[model samples]
Target: MVCATLALALVGCGASVPSPTPTSNRTTSPAVTSSPETTAPADAAAVFPVGEPREIATGLSAPWSIVFVGDSALVSERDSARILELPAGGGVREVGVVEAVQARGEGGLLGLAVDQDRRLYAYSTGGQGNRIQRFALTGTGGSFTLGAAETILDGLPSAGNHNGGRIAFGPDGMLYAGVGDAGSPQNAQDPGSLGGKILRMTPDGGIPSDNPDPASLVYSSGHRNVQGLGWAQDGTMYASEFGQDTWDELNVIVAGGNYGWPDAEGTAGAAGLIDPVLQWRPDEASPSGIAVVAGSVVIANLRGERLTVVPISDPSTAAASYAGEYGRIRDAVLAPDGTLWFVTNNTDGRGDAREGDDRILSVGLAG
Candidate 1:
């Protein structure tokens, strides 16, 4: 239930994996809705029987990104700046609404991308900081409309607590960002600090000529709050760090390289510092939001509610165990037809869950 003072306001005291993040869970399973107006019982549990989880959508509130676009499942709600639009058996809608946020505690309208012409991109926390918007999608088949919302980039740093939003579009189409040190940690080893970095712009934010300090748009730097940003289709990039009670990483993001955070929270000899193929123990895993699927990389653990399945490596390094447990997981997606979408931080205030209740899980990929 977060608030060990948000893990001491973003891990830094004597953490390095000494443990303390997990809280309550004997096993309860049965709470996953998409919330557009959820009707309930389409499917929320099957554990890989292949073709079950289809509760579709139902009144999401703290949903926090789910992605699909065509078959529909577009959720994102960090305090309800709203974006819910889930369809395929039920039909629930709310199309768009993430403009200029400032929604308190962990910021609002948090992360949601739908590129490849589907438009819709957002990474809110605005009111003067942390932004990235774009709507564009009128109406076609199953339904859509959101047209005006543009705003492509802002100061970034809403601070109610490490505002590292989380956006993704990689595969070299560029557009990746995970920023978070906004709560400060020497700005995560400052390299002209973009705040505990991993920001490779250009989807409209521009700053890509192979960026690596072309004036510092930073693609790497000792991170400490980067909330997951996957890319293993052979393009590399795979972050998930959030340790402070000691080690909770999952890195593999090297370009400017240097992920030691506060000098190293997971592992590193400090020669360039970059360790964590998967170290987790900040009470099971504080690792947040991520998805890779088939090649295996699906992480999500907002204070270790569990959902890790590492195994998409090469020079990715370390992490080959622990992949059972799923409750406090905060945002994850890999859907097209491959299936594996998750979202639930129990209202993000810390699980006890409420309001159309958390859910969107449709897992199954263990080949």
Candidate 2:
């Protein structure tokens, strides 16, 4: 096992910093509004890692996301386009392969989500572009398998890299997807483009009537590459984005809010553009999947090789755990039992592959 003991600490909240003024000739959105401050979680001070991480599953090839279905964990392998089931009894089994997945640089089967009705949702790169499909999950335990693939949404954008492919069900039961610019920075600024935006749709792929634009699925816009989306208990949405050369950001997502992407990487404070609540250097935090649990936003970092915990009360300050111990951390999700599960990405051709290569590790959370 590559697991190791690690300690966690929570730092006191600091003074708020002022937003920077817009300095570039970026287009502004008249309808955009400033993101409101996130409401503090009820148990804001209770969440923290208590013990050493335990390896739940290993030998996964480039696992990207994990979702639970009736206590069974489903994981998506990026390049292989395979969906694996990790049963509680032990060992992993192939649920089925995602057909038509065009496995390119960073494009492939990326995110997995399970709805309350036991339907599985997947975001993958298809032959034409990136798409979201729904599958009927059948059987149970080791016998679990996927039914037919029903394409719900398709042809957003696709590229070798920057394919933002995280999908989740919001507290309101709406399906939310994070899409990257697909290597085209201008796509983020185009209102008609679905790339580089957070989209909200009904479970069956219909645009929600309450969406920012009645005719569009765009909930928010101007994102470079948003890979993480989670909601606090109070319904405050948070998203983590990848910046080009300077900064990566954790932002409070608000409807019709425009995040300065091609023009502003981090906290630009540009007029009419919402600035991120917290910004980190790209090397320190190429954060991917995030889970809002207890009172903290737990982020899995790939390049930084750490798990960053941002207290809900103070979004600006953060604490790190397991830095450089397990190599590249890709996804962080809260298990049904309330534990935090994180995936390692050493075998994704970006990090040093340890003996086990990729793995799913869980740690107990206090309170």
Candidate 3:
């Protein structure tokens, strides 16, 4: 019965929404698989969002990521290079601008992450290439400001699109970054290249001793454009990837695992290649930032314009909410209060901008 359901979902219901420009000629069917190590928490399957979404803040221009520092929320604006802070009391203010951010088609100030020491980490496109930097976050609340930028990693491949800028701290306290192929398809297959891989490094930007290659930062490879990284309580890592033309993927990330990119897309069932647990068409799911909540992996979709909830217990099944209700959803994260906070991307030079085109909104969660 589970296999039947999985097969049914492979042929997703097509939506009338416009699809992104095609990047590859691969046309294939969706695939689904189960990982024994990915079982969700006992109470996770019952957790779901309740009530209407409330606006936490508005008037954001092309915001990309949200990370909480204590009671304050820090948001990264993709084109502006400004980090906006939303205090617990309400209202938003600019913390400071990240220097040397180059905003192109899809490259600019992207992911934001906060460490235990109250320091901030950002992944962005720069004059040389894409880089990751750490900053000392000073002050609190409205007076919060960012100290000088400290380069952690730099010289990564960069392009107008497919920059794959998403950074996060894993449960192991190691920094992880998702990088794209930068319009170079062969780069995904090149193990020596930093492009099209998930890199794991220490807080100080050193490669972890236990990394797949002790001297290298590459954790996994063969990814087209990975924009989301999250882990369940059990430490099962999940990622969302943008496919060339055929499908978008939800992959279970493993150390040194090779995901077929230029060779095979969606589910080729090829030997020596890891297939995604679930795949969606580009129009129905241009998945971006994701958050692992309770028992489900919540995904933010751009072309699909929805929040997709996939139960970890049943990886093949999916439930989508607010399809086309909001325009071009970009990022979703679990707020400090357990509510689900999501950012829209209508004002990002794509999609039709609404009155408040790009805003951060939150909805209550219930079990």
Candidate 4:
């Protein structure tokens, strides 16, 4: 469970956990194995109905993000600043270390993106501010190492918390990064600051010429702290944002659009500012990483401690599943096999940890 101290370390002081929603009545699947790996039964999606949640990898500490490379995945540990590889069978091993990461509160190594060429990109808190670095994955199979890294972009603001760090490649092949307000509400509306904005750039970190701002990297602004980014098949981008105290948000991002932050938290209908498609009470959601699964947007939450599945057709009618089962899911990514793989964040100096806590969980989704 998320404690008050964690709320203080994250969104604000005197913050309490949100009220629990009705738990989904579903049967848990057997834990995965190294061989063929335990899979969802024929009635898996029926018995469990929504999806069958199973444990994949365990004993992780503050795992922030995951990017797939073949049947394996590269995961980032927020506090440790190390990238660990979890192979197909099971188990995790360190593949590389990001330099100059000041892992504090929400600032540290966060978000990972892998290109077609297998090059890896990471968003981390550097000495000056948040930076994006690219690393080459050398070798093959279980014998791999992260080669020398090159800084792609830097100088984004960083604070104890609210250092928005979610990076993903758009359908247009442009790199999109989410940045927080760095605890400065003014930055949310400041066009000069990279904070509180979604930036669109080339794979090499160059500003896309087609951006809303020719010389600026800001794709969208006025975000309090955006931690999740996903794209629908139709190219519609969805973002999940943390709120101040009242409400959290799920907005459909658009170029040059502004999502009212300090000016507004949720759907305020403020002129010139775009409103979120879906809004949840602070306790009901503090959404983090998101992935589009089976035509639906799946969001992982921290304070709410659940998985929210929103149909792209009508996001306002989103449903919550696996409430309070795995504890503080920080990130979710679709695997090559069509299953949704997510990492737990209970050991991130917040929630209570179980025997082999901070695990990577999987939910089978039909194609």
lDDT of each: 0.66, 0.82, 0.83, 0.78
The TM-score of candidate 3 is: 0.90
Candidate 4, overall lDDT? 0.78
Please write out the lDDT profile of model 3 over residues 226-270, one tens digit for every residue: 989999877888899999888798887888888888887766656
Model 1, CA-based lDDT: 0.66
- Model 3 segments beyond 4 Å from truth? 1-37
Q: Clashing residue pairs, candidate 4?
A: 18-283
For each candidate in turn, the TM-score is 0.33, 0.90, 0.90, 0.87
Kindly list the per-residue Cα lDDT of model 1 for residues 206-245, writing each as its tens digit.
Answer: 7888888776578887787888898755466678878777
Q: What TM-score quantifies how close candidate 1 is to the native fold?
A: 0.33
lDDT of 2 by residue, 221-340 (tens): 899999999987767788999989887888778788888889887766457777766667788789899999867888888998888777677554456777778999999999888899
lDDT of 4 by residue, 257-354 (tens): 88888898776645687766566776767999999754577888898787776655433335677778878989888889878888889999988888
Deviation in Å, model 3, residue 293 alpha carbon: 0.6
TM-score, cand. 2: 0.90
Cα error, residue 126 of model 3, in Å, equals 0.5
Query: Which 10-residue span in candidate 4 carries the lowest summed lDDT?
Result: 29-38
Model 1: per-residue Cα lDDT at residue 230: 82
Ten contiguous residues with the weakest lDDT in model 2: 24-33
Report the candidate with higher TM-score, 1 versus 3: 3
